[model samples]
Target: MKIIDAHHHTWDLSVFPYSWMNNPHPTGDISHLKNNYLIDDLLEDAKNLELIKSVHIQCQGGINSPVEETEWLQSLSDKQGFPHALVVYSDFLREGIEKEIEEHCQFKNTRGMRYLLNYINNDPINCFAPKEALLDTTFKKNYSLLEKYNLSFDMHLWWTQYSYAFDLIKSHPNILNIINHAGTPRKRDEEYLSNWRNGLKTLAQAPNTVIKISGLGMFDQQWTTDSIKPLVLDCIEIFGINRCFFSTNFPVDKKYSSYEKVWNSYFDITKDFSIDEKEKLFFKNAEKYYRI
Candidate 1:
């Protein structure tokens, strides 16, 4: 099948510092990802799949100097035919975010912005932003500016923060919003799973929001088709096939399994669905949402 691989990452440590990767998450150890992962590595890893297109979500590039990574990716895109879209990073709460957004948009493939908001107060390891940063007045003001530049929003947050994320999306119906890492469900207990499902259902109520089915391995490191079937089905059932899509979450997800294993698991879970549904989940929806 023609695939978009909606979300993945590649980085060259020698170029610009991936500032956040230096910090260790208490539960998820990504220390192994310190090596250089360029377009060549991604192509080699995905060699078995018909990977026609891919989206390069921000790889913890410097907060203030995120455009530097986009410029670097554009240089790669000029030569390599991968990462067809770029989701650069920016701290929306920071002053003068508009200038940074303008600079990022200068690149031909710049598609959107992702501000890591998966933080809880006192939890430095897992939290990327202040626990309540999503509700901050200044942050909301700066976030709204994305539409002005014709850029979309890609949000990464845990299930606990979905209410705030839901409200934010409801407030801005004009901007295209994508939820990253399957809402980043950090727990799999009965209660947590229940809450994650309800939270996903509520978030999907916002017509503008779409869910990217990636990173199951991030939380469940030893994932199997049986283990992930429910989460995958629940997201598709809630968002429907059109508003839901697949992503490799590569390099980071590579910590758990090979590229072939991750995509194979996704294909297995959806094997019974119609071909058109599979096509939308794999590529068409991403192509439309990312405008790649």
Candidate 2:
């Protein structure tokens, strides 16, 4: 079956700084991926995995850089030819954000915006929700700008904060909210599983939300396909095949396993799903969700 990897990232360490890669965190088998993975690298991996297309997610490096990573991916799409869509990051908390959105929308491949809200600080996480910016009256007036520009919202918040995100989406159901990494559940302890599963169930109930089955390899260093299958299957059951999609979460997920191994693991887990459902989760759903 054809596959569309909906959540992957590429970066050139020589051009930008990736502080997270340099940290001495205990990232199982992916400790060697502290460098750039250009288009060539990704294409080769895709060819090996037989993937038809990919959506390039923005790494944290290209965040404040003048060379917006989405545009950079667009330039690559024009020249190198692989990415079906680009999920760029934008700090909605900034001023005159509409103008930035307008400029980003001009790119034919610009799929949506991803706001990283994984806060570990004792801060109230909901305080950073995009809706909070909308409450400013000025931002609220322009809240429809995303739909006006035909852009989706790719959320990268912690699994626990998904309820706040669900509430935000209820306010703007027109905006498609793609939940990255199945809310990125932590798998280190048994106690965390129940909370993660309950939170995922709640997020899947939002009709406008699409759950991405990616980043499983990174949730825990020793994660294997068998270990992650229950979570993956649960998401499919809750969201159904239509609202679910699969991704490589590459290079980032490489922190735990090889690209080939990650996709192979996913393939093994979904081996028993019906062909149509598998196609939707592997390709069609992403095509529809990203309008690729």
Candidate 3:
């Protein structure tokens, strides 16, 4: 079967500072980092893995610099085999942000916006926290602009903040809201599993919501395809294959396993699922959600 990786990332490490790369913690050691995994790099990985397409989610290095990043990716789209869709970043809290988003839409492969609410006071390195100003009326007003443009919102937030994402979606039920990284699951904490499952259930009930099967690499760097199978199956049970899709989250995930291993993990997890379900999880859901 041909696979379509719904979420992956690429970066020119020199262009921006990915501070998390330098963290001294056990999980932060990035000795495996590689250079220039651009179009050709991704294509080779995909061809090797039998993946037919991919969607590029925004890298943290270019936060709030949506235009420059989109243009760079656009250049790649023009030059080589880029992701079928691009999810770039934007500050819904900023004034005239809709205009910026409008400009982004003009790009050939641009598909949606990623808010990246990962910032915690103690963890300034991660880009998955919600901005404090997101709750402000002004910000919500700007967020409402997404309805006008018919764009989707890719949310990168911690499991604790899932409720906030739910609330935002409830307010704008007409807009498409995708929860990234299965709400960034932390399996080591057994207590968190039930809560995460419940939260995922709630998000699944929302008519306009979808979840990405990505980012397990960040939580457990040494995790293998077998190690993540149970959790992936659990996600399939709760969200259903139609509401879920697979992503590599490469380079970042490369910290844990190789691209081939990550792709094989997804393949293994869905091996028992029906062909239709596998297709939806691997490709169709992403195509419909991102309108690729």
Best by lDDT: 1
* Model 3 CA deviation exceeding 4 Å by range: 14-27, 30-34, 60-65, 119-134
Error (Å) of candidate 3 at residue 272 is 1.5
Instruction: Give me the runs in candidate 2 sitting further than 4 Å from their true place.
Output: 18-33, 61-67, 123-144
Error in Å for residue 146 of model 1: 1.3
Pick by TM-score: which candidate is best?
1
TM-score of each: 0.97, 0.87, 0.89
Writing each residue's lDDT as its tens digit, candidate 2 over 1-292 gives: 6788898888887766766565443234445677778888887776776778889887765657423776777888898777879887666656667777777777889878776666444544323353444234554445456788888888776666767666777888898888888877756576687787778788777788889988887766678888888888878887888999888788777667777887777789888888987788888999999988
lDDT of 1 by residue, 1-292 (tens): 8778899898898887777676777456779888999899999998989999999998756535778888989889889978899999877777777887889899999999988888787878777886577888878998899889888888889888999999998999998889998888888899999999999999999999999999888888888889988999989999999999998888988988999998898899989999999999999999999998
Writing each residue's lDDT as its tens digit, candidate 3 over 28-137 gives: 55666546567777777666766777788876555446677788787877777667888887766567777788888889888777875654456555544445544567
Q: Rate the local accuracy (lDDT) of all candidates.
A: 0.88, 0.75, 0.75
Candidate 1, residue 11: Cα displacement in angstroms equals: 0.5
Clashes of each: 1, 1, 7
TM-score of 2: 0.87
Error of 2 at 289 (Å): 0.5
